[model samples]
Target chain A: MSLLQQLRLGFRSLMLHKLRSALAVLGILIGVTAVIWLVAMGEGVSYQAQQQIKDLGATSIIIRSIKPSEESSRDVGSRFGISYGLLRDDYERIVTNVPTISRAVPMREISREVRHREYAIDGQAIGCTPDYFGMNRLTIARGRAISEVDMKGYANVVVLAWEAARKLFPIEDPLGRAVQIGTEFYVVVGIAAERTAAAAIGGSLDARQYDRDVYIPLSTFRARIGDRVFTLRAGTTQLETVELTQITAVVEDMKEVDATADIIRSLLQRYHKSVDYAVVVPKELLEQAETMRAMFNVLLLLIAGISLLVGGIGIMNIMLATVTERTREIGIRRALGATKGEIVRQFLCETVVLAGTGGLLGVAFGFLCGPTVNGVRMAVGAFLPEVWSALPPNIRNLEPRLAPWSIIAAFAISVGVGILFGIYPARRAASMDPIEALRHE
Target chain B: MNELQPTVDREIVASIVGVSKVYKLGGHTVRALDNVSIDFRQGDFVAIMGSSGSGKSTLLNLLGCLDRPDSGQYILAGRDVAAMDDETLSRIRGRYLGFIFQSYNLIQQLSVVENIEVPLSYQRPPLPGGRERCLKLAELVGLSGRLGHRPTELSGGQQQRVAIARALVNNPHVILADEPTGNLDTATSHEIMDLLDALNRAGRTIVMVTHENDIAERARRIVRLRDGRIDTISEVRPALPVVSGSIALERL
Candidate 1:
């Protein structure tokens, strides 16, 4: 028989038990949909992580000074104070020694309360050079950033971050006004534009919020704030000294990021007594994110494949029952001169129809993944505000990215599952004795 | 009783020689057919009759190529079909034989015309004018008006007529009917037999198995089996003159 005729026959036969055939199709539909939906969600999460890493600049390497533990700190300190962190000399050495370094910005930050008049808010005071604004992609919205003249003369000038400007100068413009920071008054020169938080990369980098920082020239911070600061910890007054907190080095070429990072790591190892620093290359982090995305997709595929297998098993079960129930029809066709191969083709055609229909329907539903996720997010945010607030920023901001490959693979595998699971039942129906089948009640 | 031989002047379409079939039923071997032999000529109508387990059904099954004999040669259309493989045997059956069942064995899902076209679907090289041929056969069996009706919608006699139409759609060398009127009332039985009689008169070859003597009398010859052996071969009517120069005769 022609394939078309066989398919028509198969469809007609399946229509005899409509509910049974529909249930079988539903099994495959669920499996295919699961494959597509899970892969989309996984891709969205990994995409978010990779984008954050890319925002950090692929050619930049961040070196942060970490405080040593108490045991390691005791040996490096004198009775005056314990100082175990990057010094001003390390910054100079890295800039002069690394040939691939295009530009390096040294920064030191301390948490303190800043006030203008009676209004006060806790904020970070960042001490850095003029290049720090350009390297960090921070733009100025009002007035101007700290200039080269301000750094050369150790001028008492500051730039307010977006949120800091809004809080300290709530109703009035704070430009040319002085804000007091720990008994020192610094004039505001500029206000940085608004910026979103950057996601944490692995365990080395913490999630950064840029809204509450107050910027000043490195020379001014060293001369005014000084290196020594006293703090009461556990009812004891302790003194700590630190010069520079971080150095961000930008490589001229992306290919030299890893080699330059290695050179800087060895140079620092020779100078520091203990491991009190971390070198983070955004380029390396981007590569790791790519690898993680691949592994996540593979894991999703494995889980989807199991569900498809279960769906295939359901198809086989239904088909076996159909073969048994239609034994007499098989006999009739055989008696009318149908070959064994023809019988097999007929049954196999029915299964392909079942699986193919489910696959198509599943693909249609997969396209709804993005809208469904957004709808659920909105519903939770509206009805259960506390629970929605409790969700991590990643989940709250997630956008399911439907991968085209997942759609195609899911459809092809569903049909393949049909063929793979269909063979045995088709063969069973074909091998029955014609006389016995005809005589079957 | 002596077995009658085929007339030498007529062309033989099928013949079985020294055929025997044995079956194992619950570990006990039952001889379904024992050393049976017969010849069927073109345009001939023959009926096989016997009591239950008398081997009439077994003989029909062997003739239909549904079962292979334990020992013997059964030739059809000049081929030794008994030795043929399953695939070749199926091809032979599609090319040379048609079947009508007692229960009107029409596929429930198919309409009358579609059921009639079932045999043609199995023909190798595929028969042409598929729907047109089914329509013509339905008209021949007086079921043209019920072409779109399923078997369940038809009466017993109408269903049997549909089966008869299906048997002729392939235009085989022999048409095998297993108790064609077995499930019909007497009036409906006569109606179905009348359709068969007309087809037989139109130069078609038919082989029927029935337990009713009256039903057997409709054919030209009746062969009775007893205890797995042929008991008698009787002629109820003389063979009609074949319409020579007809398309069927020309093909043969």
Candidate 2:
């Protein structure tokens, strides 16, 4: 028989038991939809992580001074206090010694209260050079940033972050206005633009917020605030002095990041007595993110494959029952001169119809993943405010990104599952004896 | 015995020579057909009659190429079909034989016209003008108005008429009917028999298996079997009369 006629025959036969056939299709539909939706969500999450890493500038390396453990600090403690961290001399050494280092910026930050006309807010006071603003991707909203002249002259000038600028001078523009920090009044040279927070990358890099910072020239910070600071701990006064908090170095070539970081680490290891500094490369984090995305996709596919396996089993079950139920029909066709191959083709056609239909419909639903997630997110936010608030920021702001390959793979796998599970039942139908099948009532 | 002789004047369409079929039923050997031989000529209408297990059904099955004989040769249209493979046997059946069942074995999902077209669909290289042939046959069987109606919607007589039309669609060398009227009322049975009689008169070769002597009397010859052997072969009716401008069976 022609293939079209066989398919029509199969379709008519399946229509005989409508509910049974629809349930079989539903099994495959759920499997395909699960694969697509899960992959899209996974892609979205990984895409977000990769974007954050990319934002950190691939050629830049960050070195942060970590507080050493108590035992290490006690070993290095002097009569004044424990003093262990990146110093100004280390920054000069890295800049002068590393040939690949194109530029470097040194920064020191401390939490302090800045006040203007009885308005006070706790903010991070950052001492940095002109290169720091460009390296950190910070933009100026008003006036000019701290200049080379300010650093050379040790001028007492500061740049208020967007939120700090808004709070310290609620109604008036804060440009050229003086704000007090630790008994020193510094003029606000500029206001930094608002920036969204960057997510933390493993344990190596901390999440950064720019809105609560007040930037000042490093020369002026050292000349005015000095390096020594005292704090009361357990009713006893302790003194600590630190020259630098962070050093960000930029390389001319991306290929030199890893080698340059290694050289810097060993150089610091030779000078520092304890492990008190961390070197982070955005390129390494980007590679790690790529690996994470691959693993996540594989894991998602595995889970979705299990569901499709169950769906395939359901198809086999339905086809088996269909074969048993239509023994007499097989006999009739055989008597009418249908060969064994024809019988097999007929049954196989029915299964392909079932799975192909489910696959197309599942792909159609896959395209709706982004909208569906958004709808559910909005519904939760509107109906269950408390629950929505409890969700992590990742889930709350998730944007599902459909991967084209996943859609293609899901549809192809579903059709493949149909054929894989269909062979046995079709063979069973073909092998039935015509004489016996004719006798089957 | 003379009546059993093959007539040299007419063309023989099918013949079985020294054919025997054995079956194993619950480990006991049952000889369904034992050393049976018969010749069927063109335009022949033969009825086979016997009691239960008398081998009439077995003889019909063997003649229809649905079963292989244990020994001897069965030839149809000059081909030795007894030892043919399953696929070739099926092709032979499609090319040279048609079947009508007692229960009107019409596929439930198909309409009357599609039911008639089923055998044609199985024809290798497929017959051209199949749908037109199906429509013409349906009209010949007086079912043109019910062409699109399923078997379940038709009366028993109407369903049997559709079966008869299906049997003619392939233009087979032989038409095999297994108790074609067993499930019909007397009036419906006569209606079906009339349709079969008209088709036979139009030069179609028909082989019918029935228990009713009255049904057998309608055929030109009757073969009776007892205990897996032929007991009698009788001429019941004269030769078919030449009819003018009747329904021409098209070679689809």
lDDT of 1 at A415: 94
| Ten contiguous residues with the weakest lDDT in model 2 chain A | A198-207
Candidate 1 lDDT score relative to the true structure: 0.89
Model 2 segments beyond 4 Å from truth?
A1-5, A113-122, A160-174, A178-186, A199-206, A224-241, B1-9, B239-248
Question: Which candidate tops DockQ?
Answer: 1
TM-score of each: 0.92, 0.92
Instruction: Give one digit per residue, the lDDT tens place, for model 2 in B100-191.
Output: 99988898889999999999988998888889999989998899999999999999999999988898888888999999999999988988
| Model 1: pairs clashing at backbone N, Cα or C within 3 Å | none
Residue-pair clashes, model 1: 0
- Single out the weakest 10-residue window by summed lDDT for candidate 2 chain B: B243-252
Q: What is the DockQ score, from 0 to 1, of model 1?
A: 0.77
All candidates: CA RMSD in angstroms?
2.9, 3.0
- TM-score of chain B as predicted in candidate 1: 0.94
lDDT of 1 by residue, A1-441 (tens): 778878888888888999999989998999999999999999999888887887788999988878788998898788867886788899999999999999999999888889999899888999999999888789999999989999999999999999999999999999999999878999999999997766574253445778889999999999999877688899998788888888999999988999999999999999998988888888888889899999999999999999999999999999999999999999999999999999999999999989988899989999999999999999999999999998888899899999999999999999999989999999999999999999988
DockQ of predicted model 2: 0.74
